[model samples]
Target chain A: MASVYIPTPLRKFTNNTAKVEIQASNVDEVLSNLVSQFPDMKKHLYTSDGKIPSFINIFVDDEDIRNLQEGATDLSDRSVVSIVPAIAGGVDFSKEELARYNRHIIIPEFGMEAQRKLKASKVLVIGSGGLGSPMLLYLAAAGIGTIGIVDFDVVDDSNLQRQVLYGVKEVGTPKVESAKKRLTELNPHITIKTYNEMFTSANALDIVKEYDIVADGTDNFQTRYLVNDACVLLGKPNVYASIFQFEGQVSVFNYLDENGERGPNYRDLYAYPPPPGLVPSCAEGGVLGVLPGIIGSIQALEVIKVASGVGDVLSGRFFTFDALTFQTRTLNFRKNPNNPISGEKPTITGLIDYEEFCGLKAEKQVKEITADELHQWMIEGRDFQLIDVREPYEYDIVNIGAELIPLSDLPYETDKISKDKKVVVHCKMGGRSKKGIMELEAKFGFDNLYNLKGGVIEYVSNYDPEASIY
Target chain B: MPVSNVSPDCKEVRFEIASRDFLVAERLAEKDNLELTGIYHTHLIDSAYPSETDRMSAFPNFSYLIISLPNLRFSEMRFWRLNSNNQFEEEVFEILN
Candidate 1:
């Protein structure tokens, strides 16, 4: 006798009973006995052709019947037969899709079936920047059914170095919009969903819930943590990739294996975010233009592998690429015993303010004014010393008539700063200016200091568009 | 129509029941000249609310009844309707003795 576990939706057929013990030697006999006891459930479980609907899945114990012999799967006397209905999306390839995926169709492992799976899978990309450019392009080209892009940044001339998705003509266009347009041109068979907004905790879960997989190409730790947590909660695989300078890393996080066990998640590798300012962004720390191209392409490959269920994914393994040294390494990692999610129940069930978690949203320690405000103050002849905390090379590229005193030399150059008058600090972006102010106030005890918001780029964009500096 | 047991699958969400039992119930209802009113299911762990999977599989015109069995013991039951926005909205119902 095998015990057939009735799913919640089918329990009514068994007089609201949760489980029914029936005499059966195999899956077919078990299902037959169940139907003999309750007939109406037959239509929902099997079609008129006496075949199980595509939406229905039967599992003998922990293994799916499809993985075994559908109805002829031998069942033990104590085997628990579970009948489950399929979730939302299923593969249905059109004629054009079949033609478009003909190359994949002939492959031994990735045939028409895998191509159909690819067409059914939905992937969400967290950024449309350097890594995102190649990721979105390759994903769309591979015939992924749906692709969602989250980006709030506009195309900048500086992005032309590595972000191949956008050209100089799109310098001021929104990244998501430009990415959609470019990806559409690449593969019109796929659907491209654009989210021209920041990926924040408030919208991460809502947006991530609709996708089957999340590809993290974000350049910041805050968004990376947010994507990782959201994927873990939703039980979605997160194909993650990060590139800095000439180095890149790729891994698949929070993936469930055939044994019903989850692989090591992002928290396993990084228990906590690095301290703010310790890791400079690509904007502050320049990267090789081709670094993201290599990393993001690998991310796309991982996404396809996970989606099509073709090759062994990078789950539980960390892969690194060093373009400078031309060396690659793959390291294996197990589920951390101390991980919060390693237990039966996860401690972190929802997304948190990642910026705050990463310590990027520290309390304001310095007064700041926007570029427009500074421009007005300058026009009014405000007596303030404009100090540029950026490096000398950056100063040579662009300057707003502010005296250069690089952040590294700020301690020694305290006397160069005005002590009597109000002092204004500006850097490439506003980050270094805030740091400069804090250092100046801590060491030199300068009380009257205001950091220019949006830094030099903002000022150049708004006040002086002719400035040929990034 | 009513749904009874929900078995967890390693991959994908699936719902199942015996078709013979449901057909017999439908025939009995037809003999009584009673139209099929709704479908019912049980929730063993979570609240007696329709999940996202339920919303996706819901029939808009039919009532969705969810019985709560917190620890495999009968608890409470609620009726839901599929609203226009494709969300499940609980409906007020009276249980006759």
Candidate 2:
């Protein structure tokens, strides 16, 4: 006798019995017997053509009958049968989008279903700079239903080197405006929303709530942290990429997988931001022209994978590419136990001023002497300990006869300086020198230390133009 | 037979018998000195087939009977049983007048 398990929706036909046993040799006989006992159920199970409906799936002995000989599959005396209906997620695609995404629709893994999911998704891209240029272009081309661009800067002539979204004609135009015009022209099927304002903590949540995923292409720690925190709070996946002179990094953060487990977030990779001005911005450090294109395209790929539900995403993993060495590496990372978002309760509830959070804001009041004032002091033969906190190579390039004490060795070489003499410190610019004065004042308790405002670069430009600029 | 109550865990598109209801049914079957051979429920709109949630929460070693009520009125019913791997299979039954 073959046994069958009835689902909740079909129990009414069997006198409220959940199961029954009957004599049957195959799936066809079992279904035939089912219809014989409850004739009305036949209409619901089969189409007018007498064929089984696509939504109705029959399993024989835990295996889908479709994988077997289907209705003709022979069943043993002890075989069990189950009638299961396919579950459908509500995603629809118009004929136009289907035609537009025909290439994606034809792929086996990413067919019409995945293309529908892509058209149902919304993605937010932060910045219209180097990385955002390519990221937004590809996402739009791939038929992301809605794309939000956050940028406040106008297209500059220097940005044309890597920000490929704009040309010489767009030099003075705002980036979001130019990006919207270009992306709309690329795919008029998608909706492009531009935020012509800075992505700040005050509006991060409001903007992020409307998007399904966020792609961080901004070039600063403040905006990066703000975006990350907002996404983490809103439970959105953050596709992150950053480009430096010759290297780039890409990762997906705060993504919740199918199993209801969250992957590592940005904070897990970088526990905290680097000290302000410690890592120079792209403007200060420089970047290869084509690096953002490569990294940002990868970011777009990850976003598409996430939206379409095709291919494995880069969740909990970090990828690095060095264009100079032509090397690539992928490293796996786990959620940090100490990370605020890891434990049962997260610590970060709302956004804060990221500039102050990353220590970019000046906290202490320090005395400063400008280049002209320092020049006057030098000419008047001022008795003071002039210390140069810039690197030896930079000092070699040009110097104002100040004593050389690189910032890295300042702590160890503190004994060489006289605590009684008035001290002035300088770096390439005023940033590092200000740091040096702060360290001297806090660590060594040097009360007379003063920061040489505008450092050697400013001094040379103002005091002596003949000095070669490094 | 009438459905006494809908499962508290029932969603708009999915349904499940509450654990407490299952316990009560088991207790009643035990008190009546009857072997708990099968369970049954009703569907108001969908076809007479198990949903994914039903498969996930199905009990092994028992028959499952489902009643389909297309318009809040009894229409049809069928019986099923679970196999060794927990997948359901339909079983034949008859009512003798």
Candidate 3:
């Protein structure tokens, strides 16, 4: 009896036995036996023409049968024939597809061998939204061998204006599922693995381990910092692209530079999260429809360059495009003296909590109130002390009738605020309030504090129509 | 049949090893001139195993040093002396940890 190991996705066909033992000799016989035993397995494993589906790869023992006579590769009694459906995530390309990219193939810099490297490489794209759409498309078209898409979001109707991967029909489907279907149709030869889960700290390392490079198309600061940390920790090259309104920046960081030295990662560039409300997301700031597309395609080019080992990768250098002026500037950023990785030969071998490091995660609760809830509190005439911890200028501009103390002067102002009364601290966004809460609790020994989740911006948008928050 | 690829004089002088690596076993064999018999570069990447590119480029029948760069510094150094079947089996080294 030959043991056939079915992957998790194909378990439904095998009656949920991840491992199914069947009577056979040789690889062909083993598969045929499985098909004969479970006819449903055949449909998933093969096409109507009797060829193995491009999505699945057959391995006899630990060796890839493709290198060992493929499906006809021999199998012995008790041999393990593992049927692994190539995870459909990003982009897949083949050597034969080199002709399709002949213009790139002929460039003395990037030849067939370079293209072959691109075809054999695995890349993980971090988003499936505006930036991710074009990034995935170009990478697929260029024929990256294995592409993984890590996105937990589903397609939204509002996303259609910018996200190119999802169509009108895929409006309500999971982003990864729609991306997988569309990308496979775009380049039938590539293997794509879709993870419909968030790239959290727990799974970030494992998910990132399989790929040589990561393309970050994410928008939020939490995801950006998380991706940077994971890539640096895994020693994987990260091609980073960010879009805000009409401005776009693209760079490759945490990769081995020309001198075999790793350059500054995002942490080195921005030590901590920008004072929460200082940066507005694309959702709030509103991005130009084509901004991400332009930046993302360049990100794809950088990924291809990194994977193929051709041309100078954009490590330590950033290229910015101003859509308003139609001008591009390449800013050569050197490694900062204060960078943790500078002067020391450092390697990130494990995943760390980037959200915690950036103070974005809710590790400690400060005086917090949701915008809607805070509005409700206002309407009810609550007697709690609403201390606005944002800057004085911010308070001078417009505030919800709270006393302005500012985060920096909180130490001196802590003496005035009575510990007997509940101090409900608030910042423009929730991040500063979290820090402020920790400070007040640690110093003044204040037992009562709260952080306004989503902060004043959410407050004004949801409640006050005349107030300007940004 | 494979013959020796190291020379005698090369064995007397200590070969250049990075400060992060450890000294294991050394031999004197010959291909033409005095060539050091068993020497391999430390593994800069993880996985504690040789890469496909490594197999295609380096010595196949000699003792190789496998060092892991764990702390961004060289972590473990294991010596592997190849057997007659061209398979690398780890050889014990007496170096202090």
* Candidate 1: Cα lDDT at A3: 86
Give one digit per residue, the lDDT tens place, for model 3 in A164-283. Answer: 888899988899999999989988878999999998889988999999999999988888877887887778888999999999999998988657888777767775687666799999
| Per-residue lDDT value at A145 in model 1 | 94
Candidate 3 accuracy as lDDT = 0.73
lDDT of 2 by residue, A1-470 (tens): 78876554455567777567867898888888888887866865778998887656777766788789998999888787866543221114434554677687667577655776777799999998999999998999999999999999999999989999999999999999999999999998889999999999888999999999999999999888888889988999999999899999999999988898888888888868998889888999999989999999999999999898788999999999999899999999988877765545667778888999899887887889899999999899989989998888898999999999999899999997778878888888889888887888899988888888888999999978999997
Q: Which residue ranges in model 2 land beyond 4 Å of their true spot? A: A1-91, A341-346, A364-470, B1-97
Looking at model 2, residue A353 earns an lDDT score of: 81
Q: What is the TM-score of chain B alone in each candidate?
A: 0.76, 0.72, 0.47
True contacts kept of 1: 0.01
Q: Rate residue B43 of model 3 by lDDT.
A: 39
In terms of DockQ, which candidate is stronger, 1 or 3? 1
Measured by TM-score, how close is model 1 to the native structure? 0.51
Native contact fraction, candidates in order: 0.01, 0.00, 0.00
Provide the lDDT at A249 for model 3.
95
Docking class of 3: incorrect
